[model samples]
Target: MTDLLETLIENREMVQPNHANMLEVAHGGNVMKWMDEVGAMSAMRFSGETCVTAQVNRMDFERPIPVGDTAYITAYVYDAGTSSVKVRLITEREDLRTREREKTTESYFVYVAIDDENRPTTVPKLTVDSETGERLRQDALEGEIDGNSDKS
Candidate 1:
């Protein structure tokens, strides 16, 4: 079994000019790519195998991340099937100085573990043992979170 918290992944990317759009904000594609990467990492951690994104569920972009700000991405495995890991991903626009974060994007991804033969492989079961892990999992399932100043 894999602990939900153990599969958690956190990453930050400096929104550079190359990653920004004409409005001087991070491009939606770039943000989605980053979120996918982080989600894949979480899936791989939980599955212990190479994971491929099988589906990207509902995704919403609520705000824009400025070029100079930091794009903070986080992912954790909330559920799993025989060969699939369901990951909850969130992206926040963070000010490195003040450490304030605003959620800009949110999505849920399903990744399938693959074996060396390029076939879907079985993955470990997921377990939520801690309060934070359970809360995060519930939020992902219920979609109860919103755009607020507080960062989870």
Candidate 2:
């Protein structure tokens, strides 16, 4: 079984003027788009199949990234179901000139594997094989716990 964190993926996007809204910061839509892309990548890496976004649990914009900064997006599979992979999307802002990083946003996204016919397909079971993988699994468990708590 492949561990979720073993599928860690990272990508960076320069926040261009067009990516900003009226606030001169990266627009929410742009952030969402980046998150979706990274989340899908993580799912694809884990499932070894094409994956599509099924849902986004919640996206919280904890901070803003300016147009001149670089958006660093990181994603890793957190959990899996019969046909879905859960991933966490973390976005950070790095000052390109100064090399400083600050978290910008985070979200939980779920993706489903699809076959050639676009039908949902099963994914491989996940295993926590290393210390970091174990920690990521625990973090995913905490997210589950938080979700359950939010229901009540």
> Candidate 1's C-alpha lDDT?
0.90
lDDT digits (tens) for residues 1-152 of candidate 2:
78766689999999999999999999999989988998898899899999999998878787899999989998888789999999877788999898999787877889999999999999999887888887766776676557532210
Off by over 4 Å in 1: 144-152
Give the lowest summed-lDDT range of ten residues in model 2: 143-152
TM-scores, in order shown?
Answer: 0.93, 0.92
- Please give the range of 10 consecutive residues that has the lowest summed lDDT in model 1: 143-152
Q: Enumerate clash totals for all models, in the order shown.
A: 0, 0
Best by TM-score: 1
Report the lDDT tens digits of candidate 1 across residue range 31-130.
Answer: 9999999999999999999999999887788899998999999999988999999988899999999999989888889999999998999999899899
